[model samples]
Target: MVQSLARAGCEVTLVLKAPVRTGRLVDPLRGLPGVTVHSPHAAGRIPDHAVMVPRWAAGVLAELDEADPFDLVVVRGRQIAAKLAAGPLAGRLWTYLTDVPQHPAEFTGAAFGELRRIADASRMLLCQTEELRCFMESAVPATAGKSVLFPPVVALPEGLEPRAEGAPAGRALKLVYTGKFAPRWNTYEMTRLPARLTVDAEVHMIGDKVHVDPGDPGYAPRMQAALESAPGVVWHGGHPRAEAMRLTAACDVGLSWRHPSLDSSLELSTKLLECGLLNVPVVLNRTPMHERLFGADYPLFVATEDDVADALDRVAKDPELYALAAARCRAAAEDYTLDASSARLAGYLADAFPAADEKVLAAGGGRKLRVGIAGHDLKFFTRLLDYLNSRPDMEVRVDHWSALRVHDPAKGEELLDWADVILCEWCGPNALWYAERKRPGQRLLVRLHRFELYADWPRKLAIDNVDKVICVSPHYRDLTLAKTGWPSDKVVVIPNWVDDKQLDRPKLEGAEHHLGFIGLAPSRKRFDLALDVLEELRRDDPRFTLFVKSKLPWDYWWIWQKPEERAHFEEAFRRVRRSPLLSGGVVFDDYGRDVAAWLRRIGFVLSTSDDESFHLAPAEGMAAGAVPALLNWPGADTIYDTRWIHRSTTEMAQSIADTVRLGRWDADRRDGRAQVRAAYGLDEVCAQLVDALAGHAPADLGPAMMR
Candidate 1:
């Protein structure tokens, strides 16, 4: 891992806890470019136990960091990570955990608490497998977006080719096993393979006999005895990693079969990856992770000792089968190569620590900017607020309003007096109040969404007092300019950001048959058109269903009190109850913040609203890998792809039906996900918001402002 970082042009500093007399461990890393190694003096004391070790290491790191601050501190152990997290350097820590609990039962008491601390403190949790990443995130909810895939890196011996294609005609086939002889690894059982095989074979084993079963103290000696006594078995004890790889390269197949109890492990075995890198097929237990790496029909998966023998015998008898297994192993190993791992690591690091803008950095002059956010119902701005609060260069405070047009006057005046910049989330009464009373030299920004354009607030807003008028889309930006006759340059577009990381979850089974509709109130949302589409879909396939997630119209007095709004919903509900296909097909679910979880069951998100500034439902669904079916309302083409937009309800329903029947649902889902991510990903959009708040023009604002 250190070499991979050095190769990627990173300056790495290694701090050793104790001195090393033998250069065997640190010799290879001593002379690498941009690498520094610091070891303690020979007389320095070493901590006796695991708990004390991290504490001692933390003290040493703190002193070194105080002398010359490091950009990042990478730690492997959870104990040290949690310890450092409580210190001043917490924000720069990146944790890589190897000792993760394999079962849910193990995540109780101190174990679960410790993981939560590490999750909360660390900037990144380098996971060895995707399954482990998912499991860790699920177990500790705080670790959701922090966990990243850092799979085992394959570093093969230089200039080594794969094993020869065919087995020798007259001689016995050679098989090898490398790594620990732990009880759960089933190394002892592997030695018995030669005797059980129908074809003659040689079983060679590498590494020391180390068993960790408190119940069985003599398991190690007994295993050693069996390795010596078993016929056709050769035990090569404790070789260097490079030598082990060369030895493994000489064999036709490698042994990675383990105890069935360990099948629940989410981690990938490094020994198995090494064998694959050598192009040697491995006979391993059929775990879900292994099955995903190599296909289900990989031809060498084993469940028991007999299965291992059978797999070896089958491979020895057929040359074509041996070649096929070798090719599959090699192909699967490509993703774990050093170059691939390095590229992923570099990209993740770049994202985790983006280069600060020189202008913004210089403007603050090492002092945090005092930012005051004044708004009512900050649902759309919550993510942006959290991001700004998390930054080291900004000090943020919120002035919550009692209503859209109501707030404590004295409290607003106090915030206005203290803040360097004021951001009005909505161009509502708060914006107008701030614009009318803000003092000189205080920068003010107001963001306008759809409803505000139709309201009197935008026109009554003191435009001369405002520095910038932010809109969510170009269509609205133009509308805001024409409506209020504000300067085009002052009105800039920064689309509503969807939290792609939160919403990009795996879809559930049969999700393709489920369609989702959100926010059906006020009639303009066009709940009727959604029903028509659902009816059209059910006509072709009875399995198609519509799931509605929204607050009932009666919940809002404004919509229910209006006769037209009440009648529109009453007629729609009557039709749904009367139609045979739509009776059980439409399901109404209560609206909540758990939209990310709810989206898992939806395949297609419907946006049949008469019009919108920028409908967020379809973009969010796209992030969750769902295809979107949208009506081509005015200005809809500017925000979404024309391919997803349709002229009428019939066209929308037919497009969705054709996509499902022709097996293009998954393809369309992937395309929509990619497009939405590129256009309105949270990171990119939030960065633009930050830039606007920091007194700098957004990089992408030129095109929108010109239009």
Candidate 2:
């Protein structure tokens, strides 16, 4: 409303109850004309821009009336609304209520009722969506007779270029998601889709970090590494609205996802408008907001990730269909414009505060599901939520860290009551205890990538409550099961899925003498063994190539293991660097999945790890048709199948020799690719997860006994 009024030449006064970073606000709006920033700090000065630090309910109540009053005041959410009602401004205010506050019974307070009452008293209301407008009406039935307006588009700078569409013939399908994500957005959901969607579409995300505290010890670097190490997605950190829109304009699609909460159901996302205005076709799952906006626009609703390409296929084959959808998006957007919306709101305010908008009561009547995921490092989780929201069927309600002191089974039960399934990656020992004690109905599915087990944290994580534990590799699963004493029935081995496009990517020229392995953490990855493999190859053939890239510590080879083994491995790594076997101080390209080009040049890829799990390195190499020779073990064997496993160094060497002699792995190199397709392709694996969770209950409900 403010943006619209400002654009209309009004001297807009912006008030912030909380004093946030100047970099966050002032930097972006520094030079805008007719914009006055007001907060508690400048309450008495009446400066154009004022904000109060540590704003209290009492402080705002006392200050709002004393300051320069305007023709209109926009109260952003419930808290602001309450202040308007309880203070001297009550009879003279307009409520810009964006969301209906529906609190749990235990936490419900008089303030919530007061906020509703204040909104009811307002003559007019402004909401983000018609759904929101309806929700507000129901919450305060008396407001039904007053003025109401849908949320307005956040105005973009004039003359801004629209985001471009991908070229029909030459461009790969581009899928972009832009939004501020909390757990409710279901970012983890996206992780399931990348490996499933087979189109040449690139997935892009713009989101704020939700779970990790930058101030917390050891969090910053770990979070940074995870973002750096993610296999097949792009992350552009939070940007200004203008820059974000500019980025959005270059994409082909947009997404808005929410958990099944009354707040979510009543909410309409700003990105929806931005994407539509930018001519980016949106793909949404079934939701109240989606139904309200695009119910008749059948072409815009996609039910699955697989359905996405079909939607794009229509756009690809028929320009007119794309144009038609683009036009409807524009029409819906105009209905949400600030000028049109704020005008209706102005009239509502003129009539005096009436009653709460009646429609809100009806919008809050669903059995909203509240799912929770536990973890401290949220960068990965946020990405996961973004991905989940891409799915049309699932909605995540609560995504919060389990507080250590809050050993509340009721909290877990509350989530279980609302959740269909619990998707957990990180949890301490108590999480399981909490899950186990919850009322018998929820289903828990825990994901254990290699690091989770190798780090020795499971003993501390209460594992008994988890109904199905997902492991990325058979080797990791075996090790974890042996360590945790968890039954085999509780374990479900699901390898990390890779997109199919990665399988068919063009191979780079084979290395003259290069041998490569990718992954960090030298100890578990056995970079020392990588050195040994190189040395052994070099002894027989001087030109033998050796390339090792890992995130493991440099001195892990020199320390932190049995003395005899450490010395042996350290010598091996040192000798390889000094000897003819190594091709320079091995290029450690930190992390990224562009290893296909590197693997193509290498004659062979080798894994000499003492421990095993489904090694992504060899599976990826095999996907590129690069023959892999791994330490035959549980994880490696599971992925390669018995037919492809090599038992020893002699067998490993002979396997490579045979590949070279035969010129390919039989007449079925295509079959090699097919083997990976059947076993580890992204789409095939995600389908497996969807199937696993479909007939199940939420994990917190109880153990397998409940199932």
Q: Name the top TM-score candidate.
A: 1
- lDDT of candidate 2 over 557-669, digit per residue (tens): 44446665556556655775676556563555434434543455555567777766556676666666655567766555556756556677666655655565567643434
Separate clash counts for every candidate: 0, 68
| lDDT top scorer | 1
Q: What's the CA error at residue 533 for candidate 1, in Å?
A: 6.4
| TM per candidate | 0.80, 0.43
lDDT of each: 0.83, 0.56
Superposed model 2: Cα runs more than 4 Å off: 6-11, 18-35, 42-71, 102-112, 164-167, 180-184, 191-194, 210-232, 257-264, 309-318, 345-707
Model 2, residue 395: distance off in Å is 53
